[model samples]
Target: MITAEKIFKSFGTCTVLNGINLAIGAGSTIGLAGPSGSGKSTLLRCIQGLESPDSGRISREGYPGFMFQDFQLFPHMTVWDNILYAPRVRKLFPRAYLEAKADRLLRHLAIGQCKDRYPTNLSGGQKQRVALARTLILGPDILLCDEPTSGLDVAATGDVVALLKSIQNEETTIVVASHNLDFLVQISNRIILLKNGSIGADIVPQELEDPIVHLRGLCD
Candidate 1:
């Protein structure tokens, strides 16, 4: 559903993505893993149009939604407001539809009771689910997640994993950029290792041992 060709991006003198090329098929879950400053986040931003490439091209089909590494929910807004904000602003759907979708997402994500709470009142896991509900409420065709399990504990991470897998289907493409290799392996059909602004390795996660070792080595 997304194709990036020889994508090159830089910030002043520092290059973040160099000669990046990849094609993500529809309904696939692709994981991007690497150490700090490896361009994982930068690549996701370019795909989401949050950043423009200095050169090369990125083409994508359908609507794209981004979930930031840090949950960027408005602190003043309750979960209900935060989840419905984007569709409400875009008026992409009827008010009744938006509200119904928001309600369903909150329930599906197991955060129904938290709808009345503010971000400040949420725990890390609750906040993550709320953020996910907000993103999923829009029914994005392609979901770009940055560190979906960043601050969650093991149990919470497991919950996030299950949730992601449950949402996978025949139309949505999921791309996750994270430092958590084990987590990625669990959810990603394909894992890509990024190093120094380039794709270091890309492999299927079937034989998890070797891929995990290789990915960890690159990060180290």
Candidate 2:
């Protein structure tokens, strides 16, 4: 669970987030939809502590794992190494245990054969899965994904979306920021429309007869 109260963020003379308030429940999938520059990415960064809000408070019940729009994999490291790096550094578990976990995650993500390959050698979808494995390996309670399907083709997008949905359970909360309204609607129980750095509308998928029309009305 996560709660943000009166959150505000600014860059130079531009105000990106204005009194943004949010309450994300456990196991809920929240889709943040907005026009470009509406602060969806900024909000996600703030929640994950990658960026600080100028004012107000954010309280999260547990650790959050962030997946960037660009798969930030270590180009020099093999896939296996990239997945194990964080856990190895933290030393929360034994090396053997972590290695086994990495194997399981790679297999589960259907990227088992990529373990020996470098990030540069993998496809966009493969890289995305590798990034996902790295994040999920940390055992995060909240998953924060920024443009999770940003650069993929339609087929790749479908693959990533299906993988994400399959992995989500009653114990993990997932927040995805994306421009793909239909994809968001398919995966998220709640869709939040943001306009000019503020919440414009919050509605469930079934409540809208036409999501695209409603989204255009609110954002455009």
Candidate 3:
């Protein structure tokens, strides 16, 4: 499980996150919902080891992969090279063994056709998909995504969302930060609503409906 204890964060005079506590179990998806600047992305980044919080402690018992909202692909690297970077960094296995693993991951991710393409040549959805493939190549224990469907059209969002669902079905921990409440209800087994830099509501799948409306009232 991934857990956080009494988390707190501030920037100069503005307090961003205040005393958050959470436990996310394995093989489940949790949705984080809140208004702008509510610290949803920050927490995800902290979990992904992209940022250090001002104060707080977090513990992850397993490896975690993070999908960035901006599709942070290496601008100068080819798709294949991008996915191979992590394995090389950790020396996941002998070079030949890791190469075989990368080949299998590329095929599994359905990006084998794009192995030679550069990030700039792919569409937004394709770029995100490539980012997912790169992250998954590392075989993470958890997957954390930030606003992954934010700018895609409905059809594209459905495609991306379904990709996420298909990946999660294989029994990995999934956590997503999204503004789309309707979609969240369909994908997440639990929901956490953040309000005024703290947890406003946390509930299981049965209670996630109309979360945005409820959050609006609380924020007002």
Please identify model 1 stretches exceeding 4 Å from their true place.
Answer: 94-97, 208-210
Best by lDDT: 1
Candidate 3 lDDT at 118 equals 93
For candidate 1, lDDT tens digit of each residue in 172-215? 99999988888999999999889888898888998656777778
Per-residue CA lDDT of candidate 3, range 1-220, in tens?
A: 7888888888789888888888888788999988889899988988887877777888887788898888889989998888888788888868887678778766655567888999998778667767877887777789898887776677766766676677675458899998887677678888888887789878675664666566556656
lDDT of 2 at 115: 93
- Candidates 1 and 2 compared: the better one by TM-score is 1
TM-scores, one per candidate: 0.92, 0.91, 0.83
- Order by lDDT, highest first: 1, 2, 3
How high is the CA lDDT of each candidate model? 0.89, 0.88, 0.79
Residues 61-99, model 2: lDDT tens digits: 887899987889999999999999898899878888888
Q: Which stretches of candidate 3 lie over 4 Å from their true place?
A: 93-113, 169-171, 207-220
Q: Between prediction 1 and prediction 3, which has the larger TM-score?
A: 1
TM-score of 2: 0.91
